[model samples]
Target: MAGNKQIIIAIDKDGYVKAEVSGVPGPDCKKYLSLIEEIVNGKATDETLTAEYYQQSTSSQNDQTSLNQQNG
Candidate 1:
């Protein structure tokens, strides 16, 4: 019973499909979007970052950078 991820897809009369991924954060969403594009054999011509995308904390990013530097 996991409710963490959801992908909602819609198709128009012209056979255009739009997919939206919910419950996933910013950087991670890019991977899913790319996969969708590949599966659909289409290119994403435009994109807008939602507010949730910019809500990531600086401390988390800094921690990852610190870890990478230490391991590199």
Candidate 2:
């Protein structure tokens, strides 16, 4: 149904399984991604996000440099 929150799981012929959940939007999507990885398979072991992958707007990006300086 259109009103239902759907979690669609798919498996390929090669035995690779993946899942996708609909209706969870924004930052919550990342939580769904983790759950999908944990449930479908362990294919998400090595994951990284690129600068372009960060779709949210923040006040500043310069703070990362400051954090690195503190660590050093």
Candidate 3:
């Protein structure tokens, strides 16, 4: 949660759109992918998750777990 969140988008001459998200750890970066798809009115044909995607979120790391509580 302390890191900066950034979405960098690039458009090619052939109208291809490419987006890269940085400073966001874990699967939270997927949210930005959805947003970019919406803005471009297109669906993603492929996806490649980075090392950060496998890392846990900083906020989640600091969260206290309740013994009797279920995640759902």
Best of the candidates, lDDT: 3
lDDT by residue for model 2 over 17-52, one digit each (tens)? 545444433344456555565565444433333342
Could you give candidate 1's per-residue lDDT for residues 17-55 as a string of tens digits?
A: 666665565566666766666555665655555566566
- Model 3, which residues run further than 4 Å from truth? 59-72
Which ranges in model 2 have alpha carbons more than 4 Å from their true place?
1-3, 45-72
Model 3: per-residue Cα lDDT over 2-71, one tens digit each: 6767666666666666667767666667667667776666767666666556666662211111111112
The candidate, 2 or 3, that scores higher on lDDT is 3
Model 1 TM-score, all chains together: 0.60
Deviation of model 1 at 40, angstroms: 2.5
Q: Model 2: number of clashes?
A: 0
Residue 9 deviation, candidate 3, in Å?
Answer: 0.6
lDDT of each candidate versus the true structure: 0.49, 0.40, 0.57
TM-scores for all candidates? 0.60, 0.46, 0.66
